[model samples]
Target: MATNQQLTTIKCLILDHFITFNELSSIISYTPDLRRLHFSHRHERDTTIGSMSSIGLTNLTYLSLRIFSLNFHDFEIFIGKIQSKLITLSVNISPNDITYLDAYRWERLILQHLSQLERFSFQYPDSVDNEHRYFEGLNQFCSPFWIKRQWIFDVKIVDEGIVYVIHPYKKRCMSSIALTNLTYLSLRIFSLNFHDFEIFIGKIHSKLITLSVNISSNDITYLDAYRWERLILQHLPQLERFSFQYLDHVDNEHRYFEGLNQFCSPFWIKRRWIFDVKIVDEGIVYVVHPYK
Candidate 1:
């Protein structure tokens, strides 16, 4: 139960250990004007925890769920009960003892339900192939009956698809899901393979003016000239800035710098004052007009 009713008017609720999703959902049901709700819970021994009815959060604009113990079937049952008026949804699935998704199951279970979703942030711990659900979700968003055509705001993809999409995988399936209205994008991929960069650039060629990438030290060595050309310079015709960080102390400082000179375009990178590609002891981070 909530501690005070006065806080209810506050509109945002974040619950950690003590609160159950069922109780939290009910509390939000009472607060019609609530805008944000974030909750994390592990699957206890009992399967019956949260509600299956629409939460009636008609005023909700943001929702974050860090579900730990949730199983595949439980996810299906709970999502229907979890309704949101949200324009942004951030979900992190850190599975414990269960494997809930394959490619097909991901399409049917998660993406099918998020009809009105716009801005999205997602993180996953295991294999990245499941992260294709973003595109799957985007498909539903673009469906004539779902959200309006030009509604999404930002798309942030985190460490989940590093292996499959950013590593060795050549064709990022999500690249085809058109984000006609996206303004801001933040990506931190873990894979060293340059092919993922191809998929990243291929998917977001037109709508992106601002881009951020976090390349870890482990994956930094594999970055090569051709990959940089294909992913960063060629695809982003409208790119105004380029910011990059090297994750590892690879022996190719001369090679990488030469590649940056040869392949990188000053027409766009120089024009965008925010573009920066520098090395740091910890790792490399490139930020491009992060605001928009």
Candidate 2:
């Protein structure tokens, strides 16, 4: 039972239930000035309601949805009703709810509906056994679009086997877009191959100041420290700080740090950079700072 004064004063709202279309409409109608809205549905429930009327939230700036079970059509219809010039939008959906086709449709709907969007993020739940395949699928079908907008791109792997690929914009790029406004990038990946790494770094045209990466080693052995130093110096000439974390390997002898002394000795002598290395429980942490 929200009073008119309370509704008018509400700037943020969170709904976590099987809310119907009409119910959601009524709620939005009440909160005329709402700036942010978050909805989460972790369980299946009856979402039946009367009417398909659209409602606009002209003042809303942020929207998020964490959905476990919702049809794509329903989700699309729900968003179609709200007219908001959102600056940020995040969607986390169960993999079961969306296919690659649905992902394409989502991209189109987002670009069409939220014309003023500046930042966007998306995530699909993954299991340990299928994580690699899931990422591989994304690599094949998903094209990088956020680079054109100079938006932050983040991929986080949680301990619970959840993989999140969050970027600040939507759309699939037909070709490479130079990252002119990006200044910092942080990546946490299971394994990054050398060619992929080179291609990824070559896209940044801005004067990047900081970079951090946590990588799990794969069979590829080209990601040595010397190679990394060369790539950074060549691509990111204005880099001021670099942080690298390596996940431990089962065979300690073949671990990346085995050649650390060789890599650091030459890097220390040749480059005007100051760096430190630490052996932590998770793995090794290497921090490098510009000598200036």
Candidate 3:
């Protein structure tokens, strides 16, 4: 049995599917003191909430919505109606959502209204075409803010732009963001090269304490165990924790395993951090190392 008295003190609401405006409003109406709301939905042409009658979630401090169909106007209106108390906001691509051919316009449009956002996660899946389209859109979208002195304190791009931009030159281009204030970063598809990886670590080494990189170690044909350790310990000096997903096809599994243990030694490790190493082929293996 339901009672009206049980509704007033609700603080958080999370929904897995898209809800109509009326349905969202009814939920909001039932909880006057709601503080957090998270929504994740896919495939369907979902609606973005905006200018609701119950826009009085005074205690609201966090809001995250991940819907497949979000445009500039939708974001503009949605952000306008959000209560100022929000401190954390995140959105990710739905697992089964079909992506548009190009997200350049979409990314440009959405980021224009994100000046006040604190945390962001944007993903476009893993495919050659999608990689090109996602970063082309992302690079252009962020170009305007490149010279601006604001920091994306926490940012994540998962399996989105790695395949298209996989060289030292591209890494230098990416470092233009000058993530001076960035403290947390997680990347899923950094291409398979040690030089490019070195430049990347050098670019953000100072500010980042947490890092995750997943790439095929098979591409590192010349990167014997020694070169790998030198690159990380020398350039990524501040990295307290390090994680690598080796994807080599060579039969030298024993050598790679020995190298892994050597590199994760405490002598070269810096800071106190969390590490997660995940390797995938026909089967997947995940190893976690944390500094205590």
Candidate 4:
């Protein structure tokens, strides 16, 4: 099971273990406020999916699935059952299923249910050594539907095999896009590495005035004010307002308080931003907000 008690207040989750589609629905029944979810789906074994009732996740906007084993038919049912206004959806498939590679199915699904989607990525962890058999004449994504959305179909030859990735077309680099003239930014990426964030901020540094970052981390580096101070000094010269919200599920990390002390230094004091901590349900939430 996931947990004994009902999780009523949790808004985001990244499950470490694999869960079947039905079990996932059961868990979602408890948390109505869930917005972002990342989980490993056990495709080979789905328990009690027959008893799975209609689930409503009205607030959910972001979803990432790492599909393990193999079951495309079950997944189609699961996807159809998911009722939400999804803004971003990503699926990484292992033990490739050709059903998922069908561009026509995706276009239909998106038009039917995911019309609100702004970004979508499909990754096939390819194993077809003979790329000709798999990728030959697979140009169904060239229709006006995909062209209007600017979602390009890209096939790359890597160590993994002939991998086809469907992603939003970008004019600049994927991670290091330069937004030099942008003034305000809010980042909610769950997998954004801390250092990569530093590089992203550097590019937008000159014109940025307001920044808000929400990150879930078990790493103590997130609480280090010195690191943030260095970043603010070196890159965010124009920044006038800043907020950092850190979340973690660690129960016994004693170093949190020690690392939090760094934020009390003169740099923060002079800026009139105060940091506070809260324990919610089963996780620790630390927030830095403008002193009022």
Candidate 5:
């Protein structure tokens, strides 16, 4: 339908149907004022045409891609052909597309083309069988560029595999992607406070079954089992298995307490998540583990 006339004042395009790179070019070429494009691309739609012509979308500041069966190499070619100073980019790559997690390629691509980008979100659902192989690749996201931006690679455990998610330190994690399938989750996020966590936890669907979190805290409220009990009981009703290790540093200014023996409440008893504490070299470790 868009093959005939030039769209003059179009500002955004959400095309769930994508045929090929050339088709995308042709569509965007018609919409000269396009500022955003959200599209889905699968292998079936990846048809080869003649040489791809260079096209500039100078006003296109936002781009989102839901990749179903496309390889990272093909995605790179598609990105290279589009000239846009993207301010925000979000991508959801399907399971087994590990190449999209290559932070080096992203660094190069952003620096070369999307240098003006500010917000970046990436999600990859991968198999838990290959979990060990992914830890090393995680270091690539820890480079200085990401550190300055306070971007952390978060691995959320699900039923089939882990979902690798990255977003700004204090922003919503995976706001665009629905994690209703998330069941078992074990995560260590040092940059979140109770408010941040409350905002995050409230967003997850009630399908989470098991949760294990490790936190190093400067805020004493993180040690308040009563607060956690109230929050989780109110929000995460389906959560049965629970484990946590909270590190209260030795040099904390607001004071430190290792004797908060309030974990034996009805909630802890029901979940069988017994709590204990230990003195590490740097801090006191308060732990909660399920019955073996």
Candidate 6:
């Protein structure tokens, strides 16, 4: 005889295989204090998970779904059953099944259902050959509200063809929830326009204490380090540590190296700041520390 005692005290549930709607409901009903739920399905099987009329997860604070084969309609239906004030929500879907317009719908659905959400992350499997096109699509998919909320955002290029964006949840000013507890930022991107970079950095400038960025050598050809120095000085006055890494040969005779020296030498000599350079893996790392 299988005793039902274990399900009553379950607070966290992680389901990786296919489950029917009735099974899901039974699990929920058994676990009244469930606080976290994660469902991940990586295979491309056409599995039918039946739907429930109404299901409430009053105690659920974290939810994550990584179903690459689920279509938009099915996903919407499955998510509609969840009624929880989730603090963190992460979803990963297939690129083939979602578009830029669909992202807007996802945003609206999240705002409607997870009203008290404090952290959100979304990603899709990138289509291998369309890096530039995928980048443009991902940017278009981002919500304006998220941009204004100072999300610690990122779009990484990886071998598995994955696009990721993560940010803190948006909340009303009266709410006791604090802003993102982030103080350091690190970015590795194929390319970023100067204006876009400036706008992105401005969002977290108030609390940022350290920054590290790795830009492609080709992207930095047109960038003016002196102009960037001015921008950093003006916007990130409280920033105490900074580092930049890139894959460009920087011998003593290189004009780029000279340019970097020209931009940072004044800050070090006049402000008693510390600037150091290191060569690593056929690249360079430039680090700057504020004067103590």
Judged by lDDT against the true structure, how good is candidate 5? 0.80
Question: How do the residues 1-292 of candidate 2 rate in per-residue lDDT, one tens digit apiece?
Answer: 3466656768999997656555667677778889999877544453642245666688899998876666677777667778778889888787655352244575677778877787777777666666345444444234554455545434467886766565654443335658888889887766567666667687656678888777665633443667777787789887766666555544455545556565556665565555556677755555544556
Q: List TM-scores for all candidates, in order.
A: 0.42, 0.52, 0.41, 0.55, 0.58, 0.54
- Comparing 1 and 2 by lDDT, which wins? 2
List RMSD in Å for every model shown.
13.8, 10.4, 14.2, 18.2, 12.6, 9.8
Worst 10 residues of 5 by lDDT: 42-51
Q: lDDT at 210 for candidate 2? A: 85
lDDT of 2 at 55: 64
Which candidate order results from sorting by TM-score in descending order? 5, 4, 6, 2, 1, 3
* lDDT value for model 2: 0.66
Q: Which residues of candidate 4, in runs, are more than 4 Å off?
A: 1-7, 130-132, 173-292
Model 1's TM-score against the true structure? 0.42
Per-residue lDDT of 1-292 in model 3, one digit per residue for the tens?
Answer: 1247756788888887877554666667677677789875442444435535435566776777765555544444555554446555555543333332234443453366344445443443444444233433444434444324222222234454332211111214654346666666666654546666666666663566666666644454322445655765675555555554544443534333444454455553543333334455643333334556
The lDDT for every candidate, in the order shown, is: 0.54, 0.66, 0.51, 0.79, 0.80, 0.64
Clashing pairs in 5: none
Angstrom error of the Cα, residue 122, model 4: value is: 1.1
lDDT of 5 by residue, 1-292 (tens): 3443546788999997755676777777888788999987656746653367777788999999888777777777777778888889999888656778889988888888788889899899888677445777888998999998777789898898788999868845556335789989888968578877777777766478888889865666777888888888887788888888888777766544544677878878888888888999987788888888
Model 3: how far is 181 from its true place, Å?
A: 37
The top-ranked prediction according to lDDT is 5
Model 1 RMSD in Å is 13.8
What's the C-alpha lDDT at position 208 in model 2?
82
